[model samples]
Target: MMEFTHTASFNGHCTTLPLSSNNVTLDPTVKDKWGRPALRTTFMNHPDDIATMKFFMERSMELMDAAGAIKKVGSYAENGQTGGVHLLGTCRMGNDPATSVVDRYNRSHDVPNLFMVDGGSMVTSGRGQPTMTIMALAFRAADHLIQAARRGEV
Candidate 1:
């Protein structure tokens, strides 16, 4: 029998305030083969992320020690994990237009019926994983949008 496990920690919550750091913009001078503007991504791992990974590494090593591991080999220090597989918070949802791209219900503040239900609507990343939360939000957004449409509120 074989068992596999990973020792990693992730926080979707960035230390930098929303609408302050990280962004995606189209390169005005560049275009795709289809004549569409190319996207320019700008992101850097925050210090808090490094700290969190280090903390998790320490805890993992302690667990290994308790498990009576004779040889421990891994480095979560110096070079911590960078970025994330679960991209989020691109179009943050908020009450203030200046700070967010979508409203609380995942509806675009600028477009009445425009709804953005995805990881992008998250204002902050949760700890480690966000797929479940993203799915739940999608359901909630759909329900709200359906109700709004029925009531002619959209």
Candidate 2:
């Protein structure tokens, strides 16, 4: 990333956003759940959340400089979503088999007994530290696979 270009080496770091109950900045003018309105998403990083990354990189560099430490900061040129990019996509939950490549279980809608998990199942990236959620999804998929195995879907 542009942030890492000027400083110290990375030591295997990763991050996820802190989702607060009041963080939603935009709403679809809809309401639900408790006789009130609701937002489809309360808060989100932009499609390309470069600003957030840039801010973090700046702060990191500032801190390192303040502490008299060497630092190199830059963004990864490839793209921003590398952390969560590998998970979901065409194989996620869908209303119809024709729409999604995978079923709710993330199984290949086209192939029997084959399932995928992780970022590969995501339709959109979350402004999250998705690993925990990704793990949960993987567990759920594994469970579904096991059940399917019991049912002899494999």
Candidate 3:
């Protein structure tokens, strides 16, 4: 005789607010083999993010119970998330150069003819995947670049 069993899992994601402390900066002491400064990343989830995670975890537990799960186990980060899958909001896009790295069109405020059309330019990560948003931004930046070139701006 043969037996079969099944298992399921769920994951929840929430948007995190922008914090001045969470950033990526050039390491003053560390350098790569090419002598360029290594990138240093610092991140910590906000209290609201932790609370949202807890809420989702509780909901998932209830769902499992309603599904008549024979056995269940669940856990969430009580303190905060140590790391994340999406790397976003590194080079924030805004109108002011003092507070942001890129402009509305993803062009570097300090560097001419340079564009940053990646997740780094995002001010915050969305609840869902960012691939489509990133692609849209890239397309928009490309079109802007094309128009600028036509006008001899690039």
Best by TM-score: 3
lDDT of 2 by residue, 1-154 (tens): 5555554653223333332331433346666767566744443434334555666666766767787875445553225443433333434556577756677777787787677775656654454555787688888889988987899879
* Candidates ranked by lDDT: 3, 1, 2
lDDT by residue (1-154, candidate 3, tens digit) is 3223567787877678788888889999999999999999878888988898899999999999999988787888888887678878888999999999999889999997899889999868758688899999999999999999999999
Model 1 Cα lDDT, one tens digit per residue, 1-154? 4233544333223233344557888889899889999988776656776686667667778878887766676565335345446677778888999878998788999898899888888746655467888888888889899999999997
TM agreement with the true structure for every prediction? 0.78, 0.44, 0.88
Which 10 successive residues of model 1 have the least lDDT summed?
A: 8-17
The candidates, ranked best first by TM-score, are 3, 1, 2
lDDT of 2: 0.57
lDDT value, residue 143 of candidate 2 = 92
Better model by TM-score: candidate 1 vs candidate 3: 3
Q: What is the lDDT of candidate 1?
A: 0.72
User: CA lDDT of 54 in candidate 1?
Assistant: 69
TM-score of 1: 0.78
> lDDT of candidate 3?
0.86
In candidate 1, which residue ranges exceed 4 Å CA deviation? 1-19, 77-83
| Count of backbone collisions within predicted model 3 | 0
